[model samples]
Target: MQKNLLFYEKVNKRFILFLALVCFSGVLFAQNKTITGKVVTNESDSSLEGVTVKVKGSATSTMTGKDGSFSISAPANATLVISSVGFLSQEVAVKNQSNIIVKLATDQQSLQQVVVVGYGTVKRKDVTGAISSVTAAQIAKVPVTTLDQALQGRAAGVQVINNDAS
Candidate 1:
């Protein structure tokens, strides 16, 4: 019976040690960190509100405040993806840094691709007006000073008349 007790004591000691090691490892491997940053527009140098700041490869995310400031809890080595409408998306690496500043450029492709009508702007495919487009090549062929002269024969239902009869 004494030998059995000794064996049980050894097993209990090992179990206690294993539990302690697991707890210690949990403390060591904990990598959650608070990251703070500001997002701004590159062209205007103004704060970009409502920007989505997300930790890449994770579900952690937040939106910027009205002053373009944001704070998020993420892993130490995670990448942050910042995005907003009418601006380019940016990815910044945390790399143990506490504070960061992100500047997003304007997305010209998306901006110039939109068609502005009298009421609201619409995409190229969503335009429902009697719209006409003039290409640069067609403009280059015409050596006119004014747009009315350049578009004399280019668009349908458009009349170009000289006010001075010149």
Candidate 2:
């Protein structure tokens, strides 16, 4: 009877150890894989720079280098989303593949809608600031000493205050 109890104890210990190994093996094998890819223009096949690459369902992301090459870690079956300015975004499946190449078509609407402003450029549809023009006639009508005073009423939201008490 004692021998049977000892055998059962050994069996229980071995069973627990086996279960632990199985759980750990599944986790180790399910880890994220490294994926590499390149982004290029559909028309020219020129490598694009500063393209954004991201894992579809997670925050993992990277940017393409000057050569349009990128590397990121994601699940083996995960999807990758690529995006850039003036180009349509794309998605690729990472299923048992380690390398990929994505061609992005130019968005004519986006290209035509960009407005070059004072310092930078932005989409025309996204411009929300009021652009009030001060005409030369308006500036001539204002008998002011400086240009700031001339824009007092001709321009919208213009405020000129003289800080001199004299």
Candidate 3:
């Protein structure tokens, strides 16, 4: 009957309108750009790995690679928030730049403070290699390429002799 045909036509028209609206909404939401950047230490300029890079006001986020590089998709004007343990968080506006460099300073307070909120038990007999532990502060005092070289004379009973003494 014509009534059934009219109802089917109305449904078809509504389906086409719904599809067009969905597509228009997608365009209005805007396309994001691929942004890339490197995060480094402000003082030493060394690249930092495992730093979290996130777009402000959005859940999009990524972590830097071993080379301290990151790629993320975000709106051109979005701001990037970079953070890492023991380092101060920083925010940089994208400003339509495809590539950017972010420098983060060491948060002295973060390094100095400890949570002091953990409890664990370890039997001495169950533990091994308790000779000595090396702290990062001590290692930083020495200037050497290899950690073994840096640790030379730093820890008791720890000796590192280069086999190739050329």
Candidate 4:
């Protein structure tokens, strides 16, 4: 009878030890992972500087370096959201991957944020008078042989006809 009681106590002690080990292992494995990536433009394949890289559903975020490289710490199942001015945003899944490459396309919508009227700049909403704006980026898209040609079709109600003054 005494032997039976001793056996029962030993079994209970082993079970409790096993439960404690399982709990400790769970706590150890629940840790964050370090993720690294690079950001570039899809059109030009150039490094994008000062890009904002954020962990989705969390406040953890970091900015890219001058070489478009970034490093952050997050959970394995977390998602990363990358964004910058003049470029479209991108979201990538960690999925236990350590290194990633992200390409961002240019966003035309950001170009409409400001308007150049005459010699000064103004926000898009504050303009109440007739204003014609031309952005340097828009001019770069077209092949203009002269200054007159660059302004062609850029502003509303404005016409640029080459008079052959040369």
Candidate 5:
């Protein structure tokens, strides 16, 4: 009889421990809150999709949906960072916020800036020399591996010919 009682006591202890673990998991899941928001361009008032939305100081993040909307679950006091290419990054405090709308300002000055020439860099407003700007799309259209190879036949006044003789 004593051996049976000891076995029953061990089983009861394990059952209690399992119950406590389930309760703790429920509490943890309940503490997290969902945050949602939309990201738009400040200049054009257009929705910006696929933007990266991250929680500050945490490894949690999400990308904007097709309509520039995003949803993330985090603690109430977490802060969020919204970032995209060619736009100014924004940081938002998420205290007591269930929903938010962010308007990202375009870094127009970065797009309109001039390139460096010869020995010095000059802005587009102050440059008097002839300059040409090539975008990433233009560079991707060519099938060359090197800069010298891609520049061949693309520029009007530039010529590049490979010499094979040593």
Candidate 6:
């Protein structure tokens, strides 16, 4: 009788622990919130597809659908970052916001810029150093499978050494 009572007490304690774990899981699920939004171009007033949407201070991110719609689940009061090429970046406050519409202004000046030098990027007007531009058409004229092979003898100062000897 003493052994049976001890066994029952152990089972009861496990059952109580299981119930507490289930309740905690339920509360955690309830705390999750959903954020949905649309990304559009400010100038054209058109949907911008393939825009990356990320939760600020977190690694959670999602891409906009073909129609520029996106939905993501996160905790409440989270901040969000919306970014895309050729558009101004935007950060939004997500507190109490279930549905949002974001308008990204066009970065007209950045579209015409060029990257120069090895360590820095400069606009066309701000470049004080001599710059050489390489185009895809010049690279396509070479009969090579890899870009490094195509780059050979194309740029005056550029050097590409092939290390694949195997």
lDDT of 5 by residue, 26-142 (tens): 987787799998999887778998899999988999999889999999789888999976678999998889999999997777556967675588766566556666666887899
TM-score of 5: 0.57
Write model 4 residue lDDT over 91-145, tens digit each, in one string. 9998999998999998877646887665698866566677666778989889878
Looking at model 5, the pairs that clash are none
* TM-score winner: 2
Q: Could you tell me how far off, in angstroms, the CA of residue 17 lies in candidate 5 after the best superposition? A: 7.7
| TM-scores of the candidates in the order shown | 0.59, 0.60, 0.54, 0.56, 0.57, 0.59
TM-score of predicted model 2? 0.60
What is the lDDT of every predicted structure here?
0.88, 0.86, 0.85, 0.88, 0.84, 0.86
The positional error of residue 91 in candidate 3, measured at the CA in angstroms, is 1.0
Residue-level lDDT of model 1, residues 1-166, one tens digit each, is: 9999999999999999999999899878887899999999998889989999999988989999999999999888899999987788999999999999999998878666767564588886455456777788999899898876887989798677766765
Q: Give lDDT for model 1.
A: 0.88
Superposed Cα deviation of residue 108, candidate 5 (Å): 1.9
Off-target runs (Cα >4 Å) in candidate 4 are 1-29, 116-118, 121-166
Clashes of each: 0, 0, 0, 0, 0, 0
* Residue clash pairs of candidate 2: none
Q: What shift in Å separates residue 163 of candidate 3 from its native position after superposition?
A: 48
Candidate 3 — worst ten consecutive residues by lDDT sum? 116-125
Q: Write the per-residue lDDT of candidate 6 for residues 1-166, one digit (tens) a residue.
A: 9999999999999999999999899887787588999999998879989999999888899999999999998778888899987788999888788999999997888667877666677666555555566788988777889977887877787877877887
